[model samples]
Structures are given as structure tokens and as C-alpha cells.
Target: MADSQLALFSALISLLRRLGKLDDNIVLAYTLERGKKLSMLSLFYVSNVILALFALSGMNIPMYNAMRRCVPIASLLLGPCIYPQRTTSSIIMAIILITAGTITAAQGDLDFDFKSYTFGSLSVLTQALYLLTLQRMGSDNKLGSYKTSSAKTLTILYVNSVNCLPIVFAVVFLSGEYNSMKSYPHWSEPGFLFALGVVTSFACVFSYSIFLCTTVNSALTTACVGVIKSALTTIIGMYTFGGVAATPLLIIGQLINLSGGSLYTYEKYRLQKPASPKPTKKNSSIRPRKPKFTKTARNSSKTTF
Candidate 1:
């Protein structure tokens, strides 16, 4: 349902761009020309959709959320290999801390299901791949013609939505989620319609937010946000969902994860921070000097004057 709304919103934005109502950061003609890149991007979108599905399939929400904390670690590790980028020692330590913390948190919940764990692992893997792919595409020189970050973001969103729409619809049709809708007591209720509208609006906003975050910032930053989001979700779940007991281990694990993530963020920022400009040296050898006259020459000139 949310996917459908995002697709619609993306389509509307594309239409506005075509009509000159919105800035066309992406060249529509060149968009199709990058066939290889577009195909890779399509795969990334499909993997992301699968990641969400896998997360949903996990039985234990908190445990599943804990597992997601590993995404940053996965991204950091895989990024160096896939993107051929260098990784710092601080980042390595951060990954270790995050992994240990995630394990500690999951240890508190002994009732683990193999299927849920498997899916959760798959989610982490796919998420890392998705982030790496986005980073690659965003940094590609071929797309550098799009000046604004917003243009790149919107272009990616537009392409991803178009590619995923058919798969989304097919899944909805096959899932039979709406098979017994007519049998419901209030299938056509105004309240239901209102709720759906609200959800769709929120989903559109969420999709845009995600795009902005990923496009403007590094992939690691997005993964950090995901960790923070999961932490917030866990806290909210404890109050709203009930049965979500915060064990001592869970608290410790959450702190460790947050600390490690914070350290990683700070380290990354420090490393990427622009170097201070050096002061320019004055041309000491080319200084203007006053002309000097000998005492005899000065006296002769004075006498003549």
C-alpha cells in the first residue's frame, strides 16, 4: 500500500517536472540512455523491497530491530571491498562495538527462531548492498550533470518507483491481502478511507525524507539514522505494544550501540572535515625599495640646484 502511494507521488513529481512546474534536475532523454546503470539501480530497489519484507516476516520485533543495528557494520565492512574505499581504524573499532552490542541485546531474548534470524541477516545484507549501490550511483560522473542534490535524489526516486511499481502490484495481487475485503463489516467505511489517506500521505513524506537523507549525505550516515530510528522504535514499542520488557542486557546493548554509532559518526565527520586554508606568503624578494644616492652626488646636485 505504501509502495503504491510512493509510486504515485513519484509519478506526479515527474509529471510536474515535464510541465515545467518543478525543476527538472534529471534529463529524461539521458535517463534511458544509461541502461546499464539503470538496470543495476533497479536491482538495488528490488533488494530494498525484499529487505522490508524480510523485516516484517521476523516474529520478534525487538530482536529483529536489534539485528538491523548490524547494518552499519555490514555497510562499513562491505563498502571498502565493493566501493574500493579505505576504512579507518576508528571505523573498524566502531563496527566491532556495534556487533558486540547487537549480540548482547539479542542474547537477552533466548527464544530465537531460525527463520526470523535468517531473514534478518538477509535484510542486513541487502540493505548494505542497496546503500553501496546508491553511493556509487550518486558519485558517478555520468550523472554529475545534475547539479543539485535534490535533482539527483528525485531522479533516483523516479527511476526506483518506476522499476518497483510492477513488482509491488504483482505482490499485492498475489498476497491475497484484500481477498476478503467485501466480507468485512465496514469495508466501505469513511473512517477506513480516512485512515488510508493519512497513511499514504505519511508514506509519501517518509519516502521523500529517505531520498533526501541518502542523496545529500553519505551511505554511512543513512545507516546511522537507521540505527537511531530503530532505537526510537524500540522505545515506542515498549510503551505502545506492551510485552516489550527492557532487560538489563537490552539497556546495556542499546547504550553500547548508540555510543559506538556516535563515535563512528564523529570519526567520519572528523576525517571528512575540510582542512583549514594556509596563510599565503608575501613576495619578500620583490619588495619596493627607495632609490639611494651617494653623498657626493647629492651635494653636487644640491649645489647645481
Candidate 2:
């Protein structure tokens, strides 16, 4: 578990450096900037609920299957509805890229394999929805200009938690997933509390925390995270389950997925111009003044007349 966390931390640092935040001073600048002042209790409760919900989802193989079956439909529907105000071309491009990436990632799974295919499709779909929702909600500037990042993060987290409450309750009461609550568990134990703790912590930092910090440019973050998660999950699954190793098709698909993600990110960056450097106000040079020869010129003109 500790090793996994270390690996994730390393990945996060690599990402930050890629985003041009390698220097300690740059990181410190952001750290010192004014941030959303959210109450600890509110953050705690919301995070707990969100983690519990994910744990609940992990417990139910059947429910996961159901979500996989139904989620793609929702994902397909999400493409058109997000940011109705944005240009049609941009929206369509997003849909195309996401769909392509999803299909590429899901190619290795069995035919009609809802668990793998749907999960990949649904992940991309939900991410699009989340970005659209944030855009509609008007971001840091839109929602009354009160530095809304904190509030927005809190709201999304809370809403996610509330949405999954029924699932949590169902798993707790109906499935009895945690009956052996005190089992001495390694990280591999299926229903262990500590495993949940570690996984939730990783999700919070890697998934939710990044979402909060990079809400506006989330497409880039999502693309990076998606590729990493998909590749890593495939590698882990292959080694653990002793399946057919990743084939040439899978490799090609991964390359395409990464390329599409890069395109989307490049397009977004091109759309948003970076801030220009502020002009310096201090001028050291002085201009020469016109000589006081007005009187001499007037006398000379009168004499000549």
C-alpha cells in the first residue's frame, strides 16, 4: 500500500513538472495565493461520503455490471448537452475524441463485455458531463466572482456523494459486504477497511484533488490521467490474472488514444491565449524641450513686414 502511494506521488510530481511547476518557487507561489476558505468539517463529511460511495460501488459486481450496461447511453447523451453555448464544432470534436479513446481502450475485452467496454465508455462520458457542468456553473468567475473554486469543488463532491447514497445503503444492508469487519487484512483483502482507506486516499489526491485544482483546464488532466490509469490497470490485470499479454492491437489503440488526447489538449491551449507579460512603467530617458525662441521669431517677422 505504501509502495502504491509512493508510485502515485511520483506520478503526480511528474505531472506537475510537465505542467511547468517544477521549481519550488513556482509551487510556493500557488501555495501562497489566496485559496477558497472551506470548513474542515464540510470537507471531511463530503470526502467520507464520496469514499463510502466508491467503496460501495467496488463491493457490488452485479451493480457494476448494470452501470456498465446503462452508462454508455448516458455518455452518448452527454456529448450534445454539455456547454450548449460553446461552438458545435468544439463539442463534436470532444465527443469524437472521447469516443475514439474509449473504443480504443476497450478493444481487448470480450464481445458485449459490459464491464470493460461500458466502464471505459462511461468514464469518458461522465468526465465530459463533469466538465460541462462546471462550465455551466460558470467557474471561478461566473458564480458571483467570490473565488468559487472551493465552493465548486465542495458542491461537486457533495452531489456525487448524495447521488450514490442509495447504492451505499443497498450494499451495506442487502449485500452485507462488511460482515467480517475485524478481519486481519492485507492490502489484497477484498472488503478490508484499510484497503478502502488506501484506495480512497489515492482517489482523493489523484482524482478529486486534481479535479478541484485544474477545473478550467480539466480536459488536459483528464486525458493524462485516463491514459495512465488505463495503461496501468491493463498491465496490472495482465500480470495478476495471467491473461494473454497486451497484443499489437492494444498497443496501437493506446497510441491512438494518447494522440487524440494530445490533440484535444493542444486545441484547448490554442483556444486560450496565455497571459502576456506586463509592461514596465519606468522610463529613464528625458526628451529635449523646444528652445524659448518665440519672441525673437515674432520680432524678426514684424521687422520684415
Model 1, 151-185: lDDT tens digits are 77767766666666667766656766446444677
* TM-score of each model, paired residue for residue: 0.81, 0.51
Q: Candidate 1, which segments miss by more than 4 Å at Cα?
A: 14-20, 26-36, 141-144, 180-187, 276-305
Top candidate, metric TM-score = 1
**Model 1 lDDT, residue 253, Cα:** 84
Among residues 3 or more apart in sequence or in different chains, the pairs in candidate 2 whose N, CA or C atoms overlap within 3 Å are none
